[model samples]
Target: MAEAELPDPPSQGIIGYLKMVGPGVILGSLAIGSGEWILFPALVVKYGPYLLWAALLSAIIQAVVAVESLKYTIYCGQPIHKAYQRLPPNPMTWAWIWTLLIIIPVVWPGWAMSSATALAALQLGRLPGPQDSYLVLAWGLFALTVGLLVIHVGRKIQRTLEIVSWPLLILLLATIIVGVAFSASPSAWATVLSGFAGFLRPRLGFPPRDQINWFIVSAAIAYIPAGFGFNLFMSSYARDKGWGMGSKIGYISGLIGGRKVELKTEEMPFNVDDPENLRRWRGWLKVARLDSYLFFSGLTMITLILTTVMTYSLLVPRGLAPTGFKVAAAQAKALSEVLGGLAWIIVLLGGFWVLFDNQWGLMDSVGRTVADNFWFASERIKRWAKNDPRRIYYLTVYLIYGVAVIIMVLSTVFKIARPYELAATGAVLGLFALMIAPILQLIVSNRILPKPLRPGIVSNIIMIIGAVFYGFLITAMCLQMFAGITI
Candidate 1:
């Protein structure tokens, strides 16, 4: 607390570089998995790629919100949770709403995915009929074990995330890039154009039996949550890194902190008075947002179009329904006439890579954020988990998540619920989460920000508008889901 000496911003040594890269790697992991990999594909198969725009739009909105989060962190040094507390606390009527806002949605994916994964493993070769019940038991066990490990060895948990994320991303991107290119036939191109139209020109009403239906049109709303889970998660990350806001019109962005993506809340905070450091951090901010580039944005938009085309071509019109190895088998069989199992490799690797890794990112970010939250707890408790406090806590979080996954997975065993239903519930939760993120960012950026480093006119305007747009999406989706609609 003395001017004479201050703990330096996180040491930028070899260790510092690794520490920084961790979050992005984690984010990368989560992005590919549950959201992009699993959810997007599932949506595409059912709806036939018309909602691809949803993905691009969601990513763009998320990037803007993410930058805002970084700005707050670099300036205010408060993670998103505390940042909300910085916002005026909610009235009694909204208290439970605010508390449940992040927690339920946040935990849903983990539980859902755990259940899915366990069920998946069974399909992949685990157990038999009434599969989900057995899976749920396993899911609960995994959550418990991971949680306990976190309570003991939190630091190991951190390293483990980095270990898991980077490789997953590299493998995933490589696979997808290849598969998408290879899959682009002239016929596929035609389908993409038409599907893009379908997505863009939505007919908002009831459809005939098994025609587009309410469930299908509801994609407009569902897409938001499908892509925006990390808005606030990353917001907390930015706050923790000590970022501040700015007029962002001319900032050409790129990836700065790949191997060096993070800074403890204080380390990255902006200091306008320190011109050199400010420039360095700003430069990194732009890079960290490579997905925001005009060209990249266009690519994402087109990707949406193409995905929809492919889905409708294969599914709705043809009446070809496939899942698991069956889906891959069909694709491979089609390609075998042209190039053999090469297509199979591309199908499996690319399709599965993103979803698998994305989980790592979500779990890792939350684990780290939680670790940072009460990292100062008595060493004795930490010792009980193990000597490595941070790792212990992260493992504990994963385990805490295991319970819900188990419950849902067991539904299959008990014949109480179905996979599609679980997917529907998860999709709804994810969408509502999108609606909640912007306001959280606004609070963190506005109030938590140092006055001098606050967001300027233009950026703030865009942010306010963004928040309202998502709020609208959230409201529509909630109404639809509550009313027993399914798309």
Candidate 2:
């Protein structure tokens, strides 16, 4: 090939590095879910980031599991966007029959908007007969505004995400800054250090007064099913960039080989290819590592660390959101007692984008990919979904969201509210099972993928330990829940 024909030198250098980091970051950032960033930070403000150990431990275990899932999709030809299709379920379709439950995340906007009422409530504080009502009204208005923006300014799929992440990233940073600046105290660091200690030993539920309930933890774990989407998203982004493997993968970054010269230098988060990795690893370890530190230690670990810090810095004291707040208002009182509400506010924004968009965007894409890969569909249908795919998951997510909110509201109002039912009803269990599956897949990937692509001995140990620790923790949580101490 001519010199011009040769691929650009991957726009390497510091700026190029961030570009590579984008895709993995999208998924890795998933580690900052509503639970950790929002609820956890809220917990921290209320308790102090000292419980960061719980957040850290949870994030570390889950990140290990999440990266492995994404790795299977990226290097292996497993399109995780619709991994549910391949998971050995059959003889019956849980999705078709359980469509009601599937829609929880879809209609999530209402819940988000309801939660977002904080902006207005804080502004209007102690000003009205019913502040929460005004908050809900504000949520309705916010959703409409976001919808209009998505409809008008976001002319294309990619454009919309750009719009979303711009605010999401900005706000995510704001949380860490504001919470630390405001919430920190003489006891803060000491508490945080002690909190980190909890990372090693995860107690199932919140401290006694929080009354978090067993169902809440279940809800957090339920998203494990959603982890599959990240794998598919990162894999496609990896393929788009070209270096799905090597130091690039290890760094947990994807290289976008042919973008504009100026754009190339923006953020090359990728780890360049390395022969050394191929020499030392094989199977799942190799496949999971993709790009030296990029995919594994570096990319995944950054997310885990950020999660731990964010969790400690925010969640432990904040009280864990609506449920936590209920406990506080009924049991405690005073917002000052809750920490980092603003940090949590930012986290909620990020969570909404990461989880919702990832699901909606990838659902359509995954459905079409699977159809082409396994089924014999009409060329037109295949082309449409493949080129501009959309699927049932989006609608399901949207609708179920509406139901979940209604249920939550009713439960809260009627005093018959077993809102934990949303999670107990199933999703979290699926998420946990899914987490276990990746560790299994990692072992399998090691055996299945080419010898050169395997994970390192260290990676394998880390993953194995993750699997064991999470497994044991879940068991304890279950036992604790059953023991009736009231989480």
Candidate 3:
């Protein structure tokens, strides 16, 4: 593969830029699922709203990481994983590390199980019980199969996500907003707002050390807006959307509707010295930042706040703490108080959609990341797939879904873990990847890119702060789990 010239960016005003907001919307939808629906609410039920500040903080940090990671894609027309392979001393090592890191968290199928639980609740007219395990497992497997079919039939995998994301996100947000407006009291709203501001009227020592569950805390932080590796995957979405230099590199086409499209192995960065290209670069960067900050980060925070306030108001007063697979179910049952029987239908239905969309997005993203890394790291695989990245993509997707099925079976049949527990475990593991992502982005952005393209001092500082924040959380969790010491 030879170097290619960067194409001029599309000239877009506000409306045009809004039209190009697919990647961020998709990313935001991805975050809304397990994190907002499952973990954050679970935390609020146990710890109260005081710790909501952590959600805001995590969103801000991940937003910066999202932008920085996309820098590589904007400049080189390749995913950030490619840039990781460019790092000094054992580049292939980075590929293998990322492959494992991405696979571990995503393969657990937590979102699917959660989605299925919601469906089972909907069917049973109440929360599902131990006897309903088979029903949940059946629904989970069906959901996974539906996801696989959706991915296989689309023209482009990312485009399919973007289409599914927009409507589902709007519906989910609208449902939550309406539920919160009618269900949450003014006092509840005030409490949540204070929590967001870190005021915590009855301040409980940040997390009230005695009551803290480090695993849930770790998962909550890692998923405030989105998980660790998913931010890196944002670059791949940008590339496929033909943003900046990414316009030059072909994307991964879907198996059925997609005509043959070839992804280039080599990167093609624009010459920083060229003034015209520099202007185009800035224009593209501005668009990307808007999409990431406003759509991805902004929407995530809005969803998180709305859901937390609603859950805090409705569930807390009744002393109802949703546990096990009842996280979504409990919220629905609470909403029924104010909204009546309709609440059950609305909440459970919306919860199912939120979680299902999340599972679909996760499978697609993990498939892309794992396939891309394997192709980049292995010569034999690259040659075998050769220009048809979809071969590896579909294969990886099937393999991941197969593993997920096995995991779901074990959980459902053997009773190893519940839906929320599986999600929490995956999230805790995701912390390791979250801790490393910013550092990796900082290195690639500063070292590989041209001076004009490198991140500013403020961005660099935020990345370092994020890295340290996650690093500290991971260390605390490990100590608590292994050494029986709580932080």
Candidate 4:
């Protein structure tokens, strides 16, 4: 691997940094998927706002995890997975482990199935029923096809996500704001505000032992901003968007317009010992931190709170809890009480986009993660693809699409599990990866980067806390699932 001289960071004030923000915006949009649109609302409707503190905790911890992971990418201009390949006794071991870890949780297609139900409800002018399984399946396939077309036509995958995400993000937030303004009562607002402090609420701090559904709760936590291995993809986006040392490396281009672009597999390390390089490194780090806090953290928290409050206000009063494929439909039905028939259109349309965007973003990340790992892990694959990462990426994308289609058919036709159920199951299964990712990030950043470029004490402590917290949750969930015990 050749070492590249560190270029001076883009000279910019706060305004310049704000204008440069793209990856976090895309990430924030991705974060708003099944968790916000489906899972969080379901949790709120069932337990009221008492569980909201978990959302708060998740956001803060995941923010630390995301920023620390980016340290490797910003310093090396490669996805963090590339750094993971440098870990331990055998590089191939982590590569194969992470590929499986990324694929298993994301292959469920829950978001697409749920989005299809929303579309089906929109077409039918009512909540979809069991009889509508085929209808929903058709819509699910349609959604996946459309998502494929959009990604294929784009010049760059990250650029496409940014362009689509910005408007979708604005629309989702605007829709939620309008719904909350018209529908949420003053008392509902108070309850939601206090729920952020739910840890302090006596006997209500955590779900009671009997009411605890470990899988669903784990899913909810996983999705507080984004869940499972998805947050780790933030480094990939930042790299593709040319943040920090990523400016020197190439990105994964799309199939049509991006056919000629080649992703550099060679590691490009900056000269961290240079004073100028260190100075530029600080500036770049600042940009990443601001982007994560403002777009990823800020947008996610705002959306989560507003959506939860609005759903709690609307559904709890009607004794409704969204579950199954009816997740979006149930919310639309509740909104109909106040917004009239248009409520169905409003709720379902917003829900579809929320979920569709999630599906689109998640598929891309999963494709990228898998392709990168395989490309790095196997010289045979590298030779087979002829060194073009895009070939592997697109192939992975289409293959995942095929698998998702199959899963959607089975789930819809045979009633294997509800959309939310599938989402929760996928999330819970990914918890081990989630638990290990931060610890790996901590090791990679501390061990590889120069002292001045290493994570500070606070970051180290926060990452440790995040790892331990997730490890504890994973243990409790395993005990409950296997030992017939609850904690």
Per-prediction TM-score: 0.68, 0.60, 0.96, 0.95
lDDT of 2 at 158: 31
Candidate 4: 10-residue stretch with minimal lDDT: 322-331
* Candidate 4 lDDT (Cα, 0 to 1): 0.81
Q: Which digits, one per residue and each the tens of the lDDT, describe model 4 over residues 1-487?
A: 6666766665688778866688889889988878887787787777768878878877877787778777778888888888888877666787779878878888898888888888888888887778888998899899888887777756678888899999999999888888778778899889888888888876546678898877777787778788776778888888888887787778888887776566777678888777888888888888778778778877898988888888888878888886654656776777788888888788888888788888878788888888888877888888898888888888988888999888888887789976777778777877888788879878987997778778788888877887887887788888899999998
lDDT of 1 by residue, 189-208 (tens): 66555543554464422233
Candidate 1 minimal-lDDT segment of 10 residues: 246-255
List the global CA lDDT of all models: 0.46, 0.39, 0.83, 0.81
Q: List the residue pairs that clash in candidate 3.
A: none
lDDT (10s digit) by residue, model 2, range 1-487: 0111112223445555544444444444333334433333344444444444544444444445545544544443333322343344531242232222223233333223333333443444321124355454445345434433332232223333334544554565554444345544555456555656653443422455344444445454333323222333444344334433222211111112111111110112112144433332223233333333343234433433344354443334544433422321221222234543443444333334433333233332232233323222234543443432222212322344345456545544564423223223433443354345446556554764445445567657766765675565456467667775543
Candidate 3: regions farther than 4 A off = 1-5, 199-205
TM-score of 3: 0.96
Error of 2 at 192 (Å): 1.7
Best by lDDT: 3
> Hey, what RMSD does candidate 2 come out at?
8.9
lDDT of 3 by residue, 1-487 (tens): 3444567665678787877668898999888888887788888888777777777878888889889878788888888898888776665787778878888988888889888988888888888889889998999998888887878766778898898889999999998888888788889889887877664344432576687878877887788788856877889999899887788888887887888787876788777777878888888888789888988989999998888888888889989887655766787777787789999988888788888888778888888887777766777887888657888888888888899999999988899988888888888888888899989888888998889998889999999998898898899899989999988
